[model samples]
Target chain A: MASYKELPKTAQIRLVSSHEEVYEPCDDSFALVDALLADRTKLLEHRPMLCMEIGCGSGYVITSLALILGQEGSGVNYIATDINPHAVRVTHETLEAHGVSAELIVTDIASGLEKRLAGLVDVMIVNPPYVPTPEDEVGAEGITASWAGGENGRSVIDRILPIADRLLSEKGWLYMVTLTANNPSEICLEMKKKGYASKIVVQRSTEEENLHIIKFWRDFDNEVDEINNQSTFMGSLLSQIPPFSFWRGNNGNDSDKNKC
Target chain B: MRLLTHNMLSSNIRGVVNGFPLRIEAGKVVEKNVEINGDFLKNMFVKIDWKAFVEASQSMGYTELPEEADSSMLDSDEFLNRFHHALLELHLEEGALVCPETGRRFPVSKGIPNMLLHEDEV
Candidate 1:
């Protein structure tokens, strides 16, 4: 277990731009970035060659990843995707404002990128649409795609998992945000079957939702003892670990005050 | 729209394959000074198609890059700076990203590419 070390700096909310239809940086975004910050030391040591963000609304999470991983002369390539053209536009503006650049694409999560990027991405991050809503509401043309997670909020999330598995390199690491209502344990189990070891980097409960930032990586040892390691991994993941409130005390910033 | 962005885009129109490395036809181009980051440029170099990048940069009126650069050149300060400049600073402010396979043109206005495809294409 790594100790929580404060980042040298995180993304400045004021520097993050917004659109009425695009989802702004809120608790989920902050917590996803917070998870990255908590694991920053490891990430810096990992020295990922390529980093990508799926559904990069406002480019907040990806920007924070760039800022968090932006060290002295480090070589990291960033690419972000979103279904909404408006979100892609906002993300482009936000990334420019922060002096970081990424290959921004407007698509459904890595749709056109499969052939080129398969098994090449070393670090992938997502703050997916995990809010459970009516099935029909999911994947709507506008801002609704940002949060309309239908049928246990797992629709978009489920779609992303297989794609992430395909894109992640042998040493890849994926950090994603999920709501408790989404049955995160089941998610972990599914990944474990794919031979990925998992850990909960950050778990926070706001006034409304219980959010979990889960990190998964390839582990051959765990795979060999699948039945045994799976149970233990599931036990520790769901029970032994304590969920901490990341936003408990800090009067963080303008981005922190934002909800939705 | 910088060359870096152009390098990752592809035409998503239905039935179109190999939409990668879109051909650039620029009506206007903008150059803004960005800090030269050697390490960043070196990493991007591996993934970007050198031929496509060189041709795109030339069409946009940038002629500093060589027709080919060996990895050894990554260590040269002069070469790295120019590589950094061409990739990051040169922007395709107004242009159309022409699909290599289908010949569809996605227009750029104010530096943002309009990638929205028609319903039939989707």
Candidate 2:
């Protein structure tokens, strides 16, 4: 296992700018590189793994993952993406400097994923924008999209959840990191509804805050339940038409009042 | 420069109004040598602001970029090579990104830019 203390200077930190500039530690990145490295032995056992790091700022974690994975001779392919071109440039530079190989894309998570990555990812990692305040815009550099999660700080995550549900493979795992301000229970519940089971893998308490890394796995058992429950009377009746067919084109449907 | 930081940046901090795009008044911009992973670049192409990228590159004296970029460009060695050099290789060691809106200057020294806002601006 690669020790965190032994990580190279580049892996330890990076200069990040979205609109403002700041020094970001590799550990401060949404996905922890050291943790990912430590998990490699177990990860490679499942060989030819495909990994993705979303919102990769300055290419810290993704480049680090590429370097480690490349050296291990494990067929680990990575896709690191961000919305800012500058970030893409920085990530590319980092990967080049480290001699690590991975695909880098510049795209927003809200616009759905690249078609090439569809249904092919084995592991997905995200360090989404979770800042809860609108006025808390300090240090929001070139990539405001990387930190702004909307009014409730859930807009970005909520938009990505549906896309994630479709992109992740049946046996794939998703690792996400966010601050305590977000409602963990609600996020897990949403994941559950999308046919995945989640667990908190890492939790840390700093001087004034708590941080969490949650891991989500596809629920195969739920697939069987869905299949078994498909033939029930209610299910059969619901299958023939759209769930909100009565409200099609505003047919005076007051059904929304009863939804909750 | 980070796009999020770029989005909030303006040159008119002194009293001007149209500081949408901050100009990079770099004295010395260096490009760190880094590798290029085509697959990752392809996926990321959709999210980048192409115009901003071109502008930044042009300001840095890279004038050979195509008028427009397409996904196919990711596979072009020439394009990738140039892009790699422009985006990843260039470093602004001594410069300032002047806000067009307020004319407030954010200085870049020793490869780092000070972006701390004033108490009143916050």
Candidate 3:
């Protein structure tokens, strides 16, 4: 059987460093990586020159991406940013242990990079602070900043969408994790207004939350940007997305939990 | 951070019209050898701000990159190697990226640049 070198590798949990204040890779993080794994073939073919991650907590998803795409002279560049300084250090250690590297930066939603990297990022991934909490809790110090997503868990996601639209090239693709409470359908409609198409790549539910890993790409074919048709578009998009029941594991279990 | 990262960063304080090419103040510079890919360098050539890249490299004590570069130089093996070194190899282990317009200093420690703006600037 094909094994070892023939299979793509991911960061080992044993080697992944952690800090008390940093958000460790959790269910959402695993769900995001699983989505990346599902789209591995397309990503390799995309051959993105620059791939970036916003809120790269514990470095799991970004490091996993580097490994999935291969490392030696693959010509892919990676950049990751986090608002938390401790998260940056932990991510650095995790990448080092895995023999992968990214230009790690401490920034709030790519603040300093917009002018230079405008319309340049080919691939962007974000597992934002998606847990609904008080608005004041959003962007708080330490681990709270990692999960205190304000009001419908969209304070951060709303901010990122515009930045992603501005930074992404015409061919750019974005992968993001969203919770049901975050009103993902509404988010997709928001992106449709920006002339991007969305697809649900993976859907999983835990006891506490149901997560959907959504992928978005600039769709010139989807030029139906008339504001009046948003409800109709949202209705059609929701229908096309497979119900969570259909995606449940063969034994009716959540497969993602095993990986965690 | 490497010069490549420096080339892609600016002091983004609010109302700052010009933040491109944040001047580098090198405190500690280190080099970590990495395999270079010619195709990647060629692709990056078109996107990089050449003047900013060269000056950032010079700040890190890398003077090999020519003051001017065009896609034509990609064919030269010598030029590619120098370009690769200056772009990816040299790291500003400890430094600050100073804003061109506001003159605000964003510190870089352990090769990670802190580019988050202060509340007033934001």
Candidate 1 chain B superposition, TM-score? 0.94
What is candidate 3's lDDT per residue for B1-122, written digit by digit as tens?
Answer: 98888888877899998888899999999998988898889988998999988888888888888899888999999999999999888999998989999889999999999987778888
How much lDDT does candidate 2 score? 0.56
TM-score of chain B of each: 0.94, 0.77, 0.97
The residue ranges of model 3 lying beyond 4 angstroms of the native Cα positions read: A1-3, A224-232, A240-260
Candidates' interface RMSDs, in order? 3.2, 11.9, 1.2
Clashes (candidate 1): 0
DockQ of 3: 0.79
Worst 10 residues of 1 chain A by lDDT: A249-258
The better-scoring model by lDDT among 2 and 3 is 3
Which candidate has the highest lDDT of all? 3
- Each candidate structure's TM-score, on Cα atoms with residue i matched to residue i, is 0.83, 0.53, 0.92
* Predictions in order: lDDT: 0.80, 0.56, 0.86
Model 2 chain A worst lDDT window (10 residues): A251-260
Task: Write down the RMSD of all candidates, one decimal each.
Answer: 6.1, 13.3, 4.9
Poorest 10 consecutive residues by lDDT, candidate 2 chain B: B1-10
Error of 1 at A219 (Å): 2.3
Per-model DockQ against the true two-chain complex: 0.28, 0.03, 0.79
